[model samples]
Target: MVKRDGLKWWFTVAMVAACWRKGVAAEAQASAIWVMGDSLIDSGNNNFLNSWAKADYYPYGIDYYRGPSGRFTNARTFSDILGDWLEVAAPPPFSSPTTAGRRILGGVNYASAAGGILDETGQHYGARYSLNQQVVNFETTLGQLRAMMSPANVTQLLTNSIIIVGFGSNDYINNYLMPNLYASSRNYNPEAFANLLLNHYARQLQALYSLGLRKFFLAGVGPLGCIPNQLATGQAATGNCVETVNQIIGSFNDGLRRLVGQFNDGSHPGAMFVYGNTYGVFRDILNTPARYGFTVKDRACCGIGRNRGQITCLPLATPCFNRDQFVFWDAFHPTQAANVVLAQRAYSGSTTDVYPINVQQLAQMRL
Candidate 1:
């Protein structure tokens, strides 16, 4: 009887030890992910700045974290939603000196509104920092991380970090398409414009790869034709999506996917890149706005006037009755509820309409 009891106790201890070891290994697998991109990922990084593309104050984060106004920081953009997932499921911190119990679960977001991959595009937006400058910012962020941990820890950060890049919208809207509508540069061809943009984007990605970034989640440009701003300003009819602008978006995404395939086939092991198809996601929402609890899919929720299309959602404008029922918050930006749906699609890998390579596939890639 005594021998049997001792054996049982030993087996329990062994199982517990094994479980702990497995837990530690899992934790080590997901050390830290880094996110860098443009306004789509910029929570409030530009809110402090004097810019038209800003979301620093009230009503923005109202629906987030149970109606809390100040829930999201400048770094907590849409891409950072993945960080929330990591925080909940990632294992406990490693016992190494590098981690220092700093909880390597969640990532840091350095996305800024109006940020672009090219310096010229940045100049067009009158932004303080370009994509290269944002890369510098990321380097600085990594330097800070290095100061907190050892070289091994730094390696863990580099190897495990899932870099997410969400851009191209600002370039299309503020720089190319919108400018062509009003300026003498209207002679610009969409195909040539897309090529110029993609060339710069390719260089930026290569720069990041050279700096040890392996994993990437890139959000492609959405259906620019369906945005409320375009519909209102460009005189698009109700229930109609702008086909010409969407064609340009499609071309850009195709080129981007090819570039990603090249990277995957190259020497970088475990390096994976996937697109976040905001276009398809938004299209679905526009097609069946009621499914997502949205009533006004083609109009601004916070702008003034009965047309709902002519007004801009500013301090002087009247706010909507139910923001949750609206897809767009202003002339250009999406509402918080729309962002939530987009985040869910991006996370659950249902955004195949936007990204051909889902998160699960990217996560399974061998480093």
Candidate 2:
């Protein structure tokens, strides 16, 4: 009887320990947010890269508490704002030297400035990590995670964690559109180009899935024509954006929405791919700027030239005093204020902003 009782006690202890481990894994998943993409959400990966697509300069992080943290914006990116709302720390860039050991538990940001879905998309910018490379980096991070936690716990953590995959803008902005520098325009039309992107994107997402990421927020490309970059091109008349540019972007967004559906249609098993309607939310903000407290919708706050966008915010350039009122922060990115708006809408807004469910919902989901 004494031996039996001892065995029973050992069994009870083991069960309790298992439950505690599961509880800890759940907590980690609930708090982690892994960011991957282009400059739109790049925290600081470019700082460690030998790339011209860097924002490690004055007036870039002038508003951020850290100051000039390599973010290509006046302040926080969209992921930063969303992390605040979710009560999670903004994942440190994967390239940061400090992103090792325990620092990765919160998560890691693999987004790189000018990075895109295609490996050669942002080659002009020099040495940006392509989406494939980012995924490979994540694999390295995953190997580290597995060492820290049991395989089961690590898988559970990944299944419950939120992964943001935002890319493709550079494929068009720097690749297809730059006819003199790239041959994509001569090779494919808008539909064909978008289809090409989707094909490559599908494979990339599958790679993440194979690595155990079950929840994703695929942010579609926003309206490029409305931004100062396209406006400064003189393709559209005053007070009017290049409609053709917006139309091409729309094709990509539409296909992306369908791709999200396909991913969730019992194909990946417990995988939830949420489509973030960035174009819709941004357009809404532009259509009724006062509703979002934005006053300057046409020009960048720091760029140079017609509509202040001929060139991106030059080093130490004196930006607009009232930066909060402006939409575009430079030729390519949004202001912190605009990022806040986008993050809020993506966190809990209606289907118009985030389809299927929002980030909050995805975090709370059992799967």
Candidate 3:
């Protein structure tokens, strides 16, 4: 009788343990957002990476509540805006010492300044996390979550999580077209280089898939030649957008969208890729700055030059009287107001704004 009673007691304890573990797993999956990419989406990860591509200083975050929170942009990035639209708090940087424990339950941002699709794309910055490295860093977070819940549940959480990735611009501007060191453009045609970038980028996305991420929000390179820095330096010959460079950017965005279609059309089962139409969205804003409540589309709000470009916003750099009237905050990044406009379109705009369905649709998808 004693032996039988002991078996019953052990059985009850086992059942209770299983129930508790399942509950933990369920909580992790209810739809979290995990960010991975370059400075465009970085929310302070570069601060921990000790890279010069950082933005955690004066004038960088003057628009943010905490000020210069290390985001490349002047204020909240599009990641933050999208999260707010979904009613999910923006994830804290995974590298932050202050970000840990249940607070991490919101999510984690692993983007770094100067990061690119290709590992060698941003070496000049010194100490940027490549796209592949960001995925590896995500593996570390998966381990932490697995310890709290079952591995299967952890996978479930990732499969349902929203992932936003923005990269590749630096690969062209910083590597292929840099004045002194690299000569990739001379070696390969624009179309060929764009193809090379997409090839590697496709593989990176596949790696994320292997780790159970199913919902992907992939943004193609923006109109690079139109950014203030490009016009001030390389394309100054025309004092207008380098149309050839923009053509290359278009090729990449087209290729990226094709890849997304491949994933959705049964190439990768259970994967959903929403290509954020940054190329079109940004071009629209630039073409009609007043339509978006801006007067200055070419000049950066916080730099010194014909366009407040030539240099990124530096420490104590003078800023514009109205950040809202400017589309760009620095030489490269969009101002917070501009980001909000982009996020709104990406959240629920027409098919032209966000192909394959908007982020709002992706978030509500079952499975």
Error of 1 at 243 (Å): 2.3
lDDT of 3: 0.81
Looking at candidate 3, the ten consecutive residues that score lowest on lDDT are: 1-10
Q: Which residue ranges in model 3 land beyond 4 Å of their true spot?
A: 1-30, 234-240
Estimate, for each residue in 206-303, the C-alpha lDDT of model 1 and write its tens digit.
77887777778887787877776677665454456667778867877777777676767765665777777777788888888766667888777765
Kindly list the per-residue Cα lDDT of model 2 for residues 1-367, writing each as its tens digit.
Answer: 1222343354356446545766576343255889999999999999999999899999899899999998988888999877765656789999999999999988899999888888988898898889999999999999999989999989877877889889989988988889998898999989999999999999989999999998899999999989899999999755658888899878799999999999999999988999999999999888888766678999999989988989999998999998878989999899987887788789888998999999889888887
Give all candidate RMSDs, comma-separated. 10.3, 11.4, 12.7
| TM-score, prediction 2 | 0.91
Best by TM-score: 2
Per-prediction TM-score: 0.78, 0.91, 0.89
lDDT by residue for model 3 (1-367), tens: 1222343354356446545755576332237898988888899988888678999889888878989888877788988877766656689998888877776766799998888878887888889888889989988887788778787778777877899998888888888877476777787787788889899888988988888889999987888888888777666556667777788777789988998888789887888988988999999888877666678787788887767778779998778878877888888889887887788789888899999899988888876
Model 1 stretches with alpha carbons more than 4 Å out: 1-29, 50-52, 65-77, 88-106, 122-125, 180-188, 237-239, 305-311, 316-318, 354-356, 364-366
Q: What is the number of residue pairs that collide in model 1?
A: 2
